[model samples]
Target: MSLPIVIIGSGFAAYQLVKTLRRQDTQQAITVITASCGDDYAKPDLSHVFTKGQSANDLIKMSADEFAKTYDITLLRRSRVESIDARQKTLRCNGESIAYQQLILATGAKALVPPFQGDAMGRIITLNGLEDYAASEVELKKAQSVLVIGAGLIGTEIAMDLASADKRVILTDRAEALLPSLLPDFVSAQLYQSLGNQGVSIELGTQVESLRQAEESIAISLENGHDYRVDAVVCAVGLRPNIRLAAEAGLKTNRGIVVDRQLRTSDPHIFALGDCAEIDGNVLAFLQPILMSANALAKTLLGQASNVALPPMMVKVKTPRLPMQLSGNTANADANWQVSASREGMTAKAFDEEQQLIGFVVTGSHMKQGFSLLRELPPTF
Candidate 1:
């Protein structure tokens, strides 16, 4: 009997890959091993679940049993892959050895928790997966005020969500502006003001120095000499790709698990995608790139060589108080920002030295312009 194809995750990438692969080969033996409950849920919804009044149980899109039965695959929930024997084509999970013809590492990433002097580090919650969100819900129920660390995409969205839920939210970050890596100064400033107006206290250019247990709350001291006492804390600093298992097995790794255009790792039989993969030197840790990579990798596994070509994908910020859509390559450090703002909204376009539109940010009614700019921008790959 041939060994089954093993996938080490149950996130969007893993499940979507299985669905795509089954379309080509209906009878292929496939097995998925996940550390979590194996329930299917849109991870992005974790940030705004409070505003939607949805619990972790309500976020499940599909049960593990249903998903496995639909795809004709095996689902191993609450299982951790301890190690990988690359040469033997086997994985050790929970003291059991499982053989695989080909292995897919969709392990995804972990929420990055910044180090600080703190005895109350355990009190800080991070919303990364279903389990984390469940834990955070419990914490929120007992707290009236929340402190959020980081002003990036996830951090900002979480702040907005909490503020909308009527929780006193104080959001702080080390960066000078929100989403410093993704948005221009002017655009970020606009969002900063918008969030502030929505009753979220914005603290830019600040870093948490220490956290200590107060009388009934957590006392947080900032590097900027400001201090606050909050009932709960949520950390949304960022995510670091899960590459330990692959690296331990001698797989090449950089910012993430290194893979070729075909999503194959150093070992030809092993492939990676989603937040865990750095494909062709690009670590696109987002939904669109995951879908595109899964589609292309599915074809490759079915004996057809295919490469993922990602077009300029826009990111929709879920802050209803300040609706925003960002698209194209805004990471070009050499690009210049041409911004125009008014009472209606703000449109910030990025242009390279050659005067070509490389990226744009649109808020309010001007979001309609995103589609046109996206068409003009070049493919990300």
Candidate 2:
């Protein structure tokens, strides 16, 4: 007779929330509506599955039916939330209306696809979810070489993965270095060289102008004037938060769905987390923040207001060619960092205006110092 708590995603954020909430209140009615197959899998695994020789099916931790039964929650798969009626405390999904005691928007972000000029229908792929990965696997199986656009976290990891699979990989980006937003030139240059040593062709500081269909492969035109014909094309540009439903419902949104420290959106009964949420004017799409938010949101859902603990987060890049660890805030792409490099490894630290330790990067054998440097980074988030 009572409405169930509705979550609008099935990603790690949604899974963790349900797990955390169930720990305190096992009998609470919960429902998850997902656009995908609702399989339980670590999304981060998609990027490096190739290195492990794993398929999309292998990446699945649990199926939708199994997850639903295990958690004792309703799972609506292959469904999309069409709209949200914030005032009515209900949402329309697939032409059906559902009411909720509390609405959690864990919709997550979408893979950003840059605009291309030529015919780029089935030739290009961006792996953001299970289905996308499946589609990419099909393309990669027949392709001998791959062109990866955007040398960010996803781009670099995927390039390394493809190379490990014995595919010729060409990594390109608008920035002069890989992971420009997260690493300084010195740090990225080291990674660039490492990937190069691993047989990856690094194409930096160029824009992809068009994608045309060639006789045997896809023709990619770069703004730098050099052209290439590759068997496959993949884009790892970045992600943009899913804020449409929130914004359409009049919820406050900036870079993401605006939320307080408690993960509460503009509406009292609505909350958001993970890639879709901006908490306290900051949007963090990292794993640690998502886990912290889920734990805090679970407390709030159980009738207690708890704020997520802001700590300097650590991210371990999945490139085995050159292992990397980043701690603290490296959100600024133009940060002036001081770096020290040796054959053993590389270490870079960022400082604030007042000489406070703000961020640092460690790569290769130098990760032994990651735990200590993580402590030195400021909790700016």
Candidate 3:
């Protein structure tokens, strides 16, 4: 009898892992459990729905039942795991204990919302998962204005979505510009202007101090002695790895559940991937890295002792208002860079001491060089 495989979490990693594994062995029994509704959708697409003229419902790629039927695997939608016993190879859910031969965790990350002063209770949302998106859609209907707490990729995308829906949007960040996590300073300037031109007021270098409730709305106060009254607030600060379960199960963990190049956790019977797993000491929160990790993990499950060697994975922002792609790590100390910028666009390339290209950033019109530049970069661990 083939051993039953159990997979936790239903995100890009989980879906792709199942697809890739089934392609190699169709008869293996597999089960997927998720806490949220199991309609598979691209997670990034959640923020840019309005720009693409797509509805929240339209974003669902496959229903849970359909996915299970299509892949010949069991799909447990809206099911939550309470505990995992790694020694016994058992998982507890809703008072039921299930045994598995091997376990895979695709438990993705959660939005990080810093603690701030506010009414003890108010309408605040985080754009982390599908449920969050559905809640945001409902909040937008009743909102006349919105206060966004972070101006990173997700925050900027959410602000732009709200603005396009004709709601007054105010985007604030502790950093001095949008795309601070991914784009360089010169590149950010163009994005700042582009968003500003579209009526999205950016309040960089500021933090949300508190939220005051009004009779019919809310007023958002910043630490810099500024106040703006708005209808609702959305927090998109950043993401934290979902590692509590793996940690509690006695698996080795650092910033995330530590995994090797083959995506296997400390326990050979257990594996971890996606935003929740730290591979080669790197927690990649981007799509390309996630895809590459899934493919490599699947190959290992198919009886190959393979290590996933990642090329410099590029980060692409779908802010159609300002499309940009960045490849490789920009924080390399051993590399010198040459930057080219304009009011419209910018490009920067980091070259090693030996004159080999190591990393790059592309913004606006220079985004066309993304592929060529990444092709020249050295492989990232």
Candidate 4:
């Protein structure tokens, strides 16, 4: 009897990796272990909650049984990988062990809950996985007014979803603008105004002071000493990659699990992808990057030693109300940019001193230019 190839997650990264590997070698004895139910689903659908009119149950695209039967792969549903013995190449789980010809860590990231006090016992939710979403959905049903803490992509999306649901939504952030890391000030202002038109309250340049459980609801204390009452609170603050496991195993880690172009970690037999990995200091938290990483890693698993090179990845922020297509490494580029705005949408272009297009943000229907700009962008090595 031979050991199976073990994968430690079922998110976009792990799912794509398994799907690609199965296509190349169906008899590879693959086993997927997930902390969640191992249900197959597009995680990004969580943000499209309002537009899709989906409940927590309806949001799930596929079940574990469906995936297992469809792929003829073994699914260890709702199992936790306690730790990995990298030197011995084994993963331990509940008095049992699994050996792998190769192991991939797609463990993903956890939402960072700020150090604050309040009815901190689950009244406040973070949308990181199915379980978290399920819990949040229940609270959302009872919430007439919702408080969202953060103005980043996830936070803004959730705020829009809640507002679309007719829930009075209040959003706050430490940055002066929404999606500070992804969009320019003017573009963010455009989105802020758009959300306002949709009846969302914005609180930029503010932070959460504390949270307190009021009668039959919660009160969110703001840094400016202002308190707002809301039926539910969602901490869409941000995410930090789950690298403790990899770090504990003596594998080299930086912002994420540092991987080579082949998606191989410091240990040759171990590989990482998704939010938990930082390939050449690039931890892409988008769908396109995840798909690319999966494809590249799958080739390596099938005995092809190929390096994965990425083009400037484009992301559409599912704000159907705002309609935008944004792209490039907007988060890390230290360069000047040009902004063009009209009734159509705003186009913000970042260029290097050498006059190379590095990043861009296109809002509303005017984002059609993204395809043309994407073709002209350089390879993200």
**What TM-score, over all chains together, does every model reach?**
0.96, 0.95, 0.94, 0.95
TM-score of 2: 0.95
What does candidate 1's lDDT look like per residue over 1-381, in tens digits? 678989999999999999899989998899999999998999989878878888899999999998989889999999999999999999999899999998999999999998889799888899999889887787786678999999999999999998888899999998888998887776777788888887888888889999999877999999889898999999999999999999999999999999999999999999998999997777888898899899999998878999888888989987788898989867567789887777778788889889999998899888888899889887888
lDDT for each of the candidates?
Answer: 0.90, 0.88, 0.83, 0.84
The residue pairs that clash in candidate 1, if any, are none
Q: Per-residue lDDT tens digits of candidate 2, residues 1-381?
A: 668999999999999999999889988999999999999999889878777878899999899999999999999999999999999999999898999999999999998887889986467788888889876786687788999998999899999999988999999998988887787777777788889998898889898999999887899899999898899999989899999999999999999999998899999999998999997777888888899889989999989999888777789998897898987766555466777888878888888777777888888898888889888876755
RMSD of each: 1.4, 1.8, 2.0, 1.8
Clashing pairs in 2: none
Off by over 4 Å in 1: 331-334, 340-342
Q: By lDDT, highest first, what's the ranking?
A: 1, 2, 4, 3
For model 2, how big is the CA root-mean-square deviation?
1.8
- Name model 2 segments beyond 4 Å from true: 330-342
* Candidate 1: residue 16 lDDT (0-100): 91
Error of 4 at 116 (Å): 1.2
lDDT of 3 by residue, 24-84 (tens): 8899899898998887888888777655656678888998888899999988888999999
The deviation in Å at residue 362 for candidate 2 is: 1.5
Model 3: which residue pairs collide? none
Question: Which has the greatest lDDT?
Answer: 1
TM-score of 1: 0.96
